[model samples]
Target: MDTTYTGDVTPGGAPDVRELPHLRITKLAVDPQMSNNCYLLTCRSTGESVLVDAADDAAALLRLCDAALEGVVTTHQHWDHHRGLAEVVAATGATTYAGAPDADAISEQTGIAVDVRLQHGDRIVVGDQSLEVLAIAGHTPGSVALLYADPDGHAHLFTGDSLFPGGVGNTFGDEQAFATLVHEVETKVFDRLPDDTWFYPGHGNDGRLGDERPHLAEWRERGW
Candidate 1:
């Protein structure tokens, strides 16, 4: 199924999985129409893959799973990010997971109940890889991020919409929400995680913790 990513490619446009050798980080850029980033993390040892954010184009996402899909984790319940949730869940029958607080909210929106309600510090296993859940509420009350470290100690973070490259996600004009997001990003993402950690956002280009480190104060002072 060519799960391995090829060349020096940047993620955008048509969906394709970019496989990383150090750790099998499959960046599945799904739903070109929406340009949503759906990631598939595959364990080379067991071939079991976990799909992050089944955003759009269910058929394309299902094809990327290639029948080895173990589960689907919805980063947040935002409509744009979960358009294909019900379809993918119905087809694959893979257990759907979401933050505990947002489970019912997401289910109400998508019509598919969350099988697992993840909380901060919970662990989700994809074959040999273990993803640690970090609830970074801001963009949505239940917005979350998943952190996984490969054998080489490199960490990968799947940040739904809380943390981004230039600044924190939009707060819809709510100052408190923006503050919550920045605090969470500082404490959980920036303060705890290392510089080299690669983060895949909900949309657009991916970024490293190091890339956004210098601008933390600026983001906070400006307040998204």
Candidate 2:
């Protein structure tokens, strides 16, 4: 299995694929305007897969699957995150999952009902593997991060827009929102996971927990 993927991608370009012992992760950038990152996680053993954030470009996303897709998980209710959700779900008949608080908004936006409303500590099974849901509110009332604890190695986190390389997601200058996002990220993520944990964000590149650990205080102080 290859673990050297850089997670770099561009809209309308090919996806960056990473092969783990039990899972295969493909990161694709969609929506030129939003530059949203969509991830497909496949269980090697069972051939079952789950797509995180349909984002946009239904044709491209469907091609990425290449076969059956078990489910789609939207991290938040942001419009850019689910632009292609309805189309993808219609074609693949995949179950839709999203954080409870944002489920209604996502359903309203996409015209597709969320099959499962996830909460913190919930487990989403994809074939033989499962992802733990870590609800990190602030970016949105229901923003969630999916954590896959690789039995063979360290954990992999699909953080959506709640956490990123430099700092937490945009809180729109709301001090309360910023505080909530940063606090949850530190407590639920940094304090709980090891430094080696690799994180995949909703947009742009991926990062390691260890690489961003030292700057947590700085991020908080800056109040972004």
Candidate 3:
């Protein structure tokens, strides 16, 4: 299991978790080049951490999180973002959490303990950090969006595939869900969360919620 990330993201040609995020993010460009984003929210003050969106080669991400990793948070149950969950839990021995309805979907994809099932209004307490679970199910029947905020008001969101920069999630479920996604992003995410919150999506690139807020609203108006 040479699960280390030895690709182009290395330093001196070596995998560099140091560069990943001395604080809370480790994006990996996986095989087939889907370039998904995973996260490790660490509170140096409390010495505890939580991982979100387990990518392929879990050991590598675990190595980046160190031993203080206490939990796993899947923004949603999508293949590219959660395929290595079993390896992550095995490496870190942390409890895994996801949307309540998507629990089985996540379990089937990642053979790890589903310690907690979250809902739209659910709050995840990890050390000193608190994350709110948003049910933005449009890309899939049970898609979820995870949002974290600090006491200082700094925020981070894992928008699975439900919301992206300049675009929303791709529809692959009941046709009505696409409409739901449209409304959800506007009323739930765009109107609810502040524009400055960092949004780490499941694919392509990462950005701020504010950066795409207008587009999200416009998309909804267009009936997309």
Candidate 4:
């Protein structure tokens, strides 16, 4: 990967294709391309935006902004999913937000100091847009998924590495903390989110709630 990388689609089955009103979601593929999914959410009314997972090229992320950069929300502290935190904030003066428990790690990367530290069930506001930060740990101690609504009231899940399109993220990387990822996904991430909300994984394509609903049983079998 170079300093200024371009975005693309993740591999595997066809990627999630959503057509939301007043909001556009672009799957900006980045390094370690398989499971790193980055997103851009732009408000139609204000031309302001919030970016999810600035783990890619800061320049590329900015180019994709196309609107004023309001903030960067990290789903977890993984380097591949968060390497651009400093560049993004420096470029836009945007605040840094993450699972409140991740404040230390986020602060270390951001250096502007963390403006907001959120826990599960907390929501951060950017313009009229409010993104509900759900603590979905396991893949990491502080992985979070931002659940927000589209204009028509449809919900979108920007799930980190906890869940994915066809399969779920591998928990072996966590060593002793593997259970955290599984429990967080089955209980925290999937428990509250409607079975109908669209699930976008950190490193893969999107899977609608309806489409991947059955996989929940399999995910639970692993004992979260």
Local distance difference test, per candidate? 0.82, 0.95, 0.69, 0.69
TM-score of candidate 3 relative to the true fold: 0.82
lDDT of candidate model 1 versus the reference: 0.82
- Against the true structure, whose lDDT is highest? 2
Top-TM-score structure, candidate number? 2
After superposition, the stretches of candidate 2 with alpha carbons farther than 4 Å from their true spots are none
TM-score ranking of the models: 2, 1, 3, 4
Residue-level lDDT tens digits of model 4 in 1-224:
12222233753322232335566566676664434667877765776778888886777777777548788888777677778778888878887787767768867765646677778788877566777887866666777888876657657788877777665666665544656665666676566667677777776546777676677667556643
lDDT of 3 by residue, 19-90 (tens): 222243455545456666666666646767887777776666766777788888877777887877888788
Q: Write the per-residue lDDT of candidate 2 for residues 167-206, one digit (tens) a residue.
A: 9999998999999999999999999999999999999999
**Backbone atom clashes (below 3 Å) for every candidate:** 2, 0, 1, 9
**Alpha-carbon error at 131 in model 4, in Å?**
1.0
Off by over 4 Å in 4: 1-19, 32-35, 109-112, 151-153, 173-176, 222-224
Displacement of the residue 5 alpha carbon in candidate 1, Å = 6.0
- Which scores greater on TM-score, model 1 or model 2? 2
